[model samples]
Target: MVAQLRIYTINRGMMASWLQLFYEHIRPLHERLGMPVQNAWVNAERTEFIWVRSFNDREEIEAKEAAYFASPERTALGDQPTRHIAKIEVRVMEEVPATAGVS
Candidate 1:
């Protein structure tokens, strides 16, 4: 299994709108496309949105992401958040089973 961590930096004064758009639109689209989100969080100042999604493998992740971004729904609603986002960072990670039970 693998996880994708995405961090989105919102433009000044646009955090609330961006979050709304993400949860109302983007997140559901992703979930329907097979990329189930594990968790979501905001930074202390609320300027950044961070989320994690799990996949069976890297290929699954790539395929789901490709389909999601290329879909008609995405084409229509995808840009809604772009204007509000200053930057985005994505990281693919593998869990360390050895530490699974360790706090």
Candidate 2:
């Protein structure tokens, strides 16, 4: 599976609206898409929202996400104020092995 990190940078006073979109659109969409969302966070500074979602493969991930976001519902939501999102960063992360084995 591949993981995606989406960082949304909000406009100066758009936190409330952005969060509304998160609940009204994003979270529901994730559930509908059957994508496993590992975590969701709102920055302490309150200017960003971060989400970690995983998909079985890269191609499926891209296609599904593209279609989802391209839909009219999302397009209208995207029109809301945001600093254009900091960036949508995706990566393949590896878990570090633990050294403590035997008790």
Candidate 3:
């Protein structure tokens, strides 16, 4: 299995509003992505927020993410905040030991 992490450094001024909008609109798509979300984070000083997106395998992650991103609904949600996202990063890692609980 492969585990992925998505870190989003968001603009401080818009955190609360963006978080609410994200939960309201993006949460469902993230869930429907059929991927595990390890957790979402907010910095101690409320400077940035990080989101962890986990996947079971590379094939599943690569194949599914495009469709998720291509959807019209997803596009709209992504367009919500223009200046909110300061920086976005993704990390993909293969587990040292295999865990095949993917169904």
Candidate 4:
């Protein structure tokens, strides 16, 4: 499986508002699109919001994300969600396949 580690740098003093939007709207929308958020975290300083999403493969990520960004539901959210984001960093990772002789 492939996993994407998403880290968002929330605007200063907007962590609470961003988290509200994420839980109430962003995460729910992703779930409806078959892109479940595996887990999430916030730095102690509250400047960074981190989350992970797993997919069957890289192509699945591309397809689902394309639909996600193009969804009318996402459009309806307008700038409410994005306004709090100051920066975004994404890292794609894949699980190491087991070898036949390896335990």
Error of 1 at 29 (Å): 0.6
Query: What total of clashing residue pairs does each candidate reach?
Result: 0, 0, 0, 0
Q: Name the weakest run of 10 consecutive residues (lDDT summed) in model 2.
A: 80-89
Q: Each candidate's lDDT (Cα)?
A: 0.87, 0.69, 0.75, 0.92
lDDT of 2: 0.69
**Which residue pairs in candidate 1 collide?**
none
Give the distance in Å from residue 43's predicted Cα in candidate 3 to where it truly belongs.
Answer: 0.8
Question: Per-residue lDDT for 1-103 in model 3, tens only?
Answer: 6777666778768889878977776767778878666678888484677777767778898777887788788787666755678787788888774556755
Higher-ranked by lDDT: 3 or 4: 4
RMSD of 1: 2.7
Candidate 2 lDDT by residue in tens digits, 1-103: 6677877666656777777877778777777776767888888496777888877776777788787777776677765433445444555543334664655
lDDT of 4 at 45: 88
Which stretches in model 4 have alpha-carbon errors above 4 Å? 98-103
Checking candidate 4 for backbone clashes, the offending pairs are: none
Q: What tens-digit string does per-residue lDDT give for candidate 1 at 1-103?
A: 8999999888878877888888898889888888898999989485888999999988787778789889998999847868988899999998779878898
Model 1 score (lDDT) = 0.87
Candidate numbers, best TM-score first, in rank order: 4, 1, 3, 2
Per-residue lDDT for 59 in model 2? 70
Candidate 1, residue 71: how far the Cα is off, in Å = 1.1
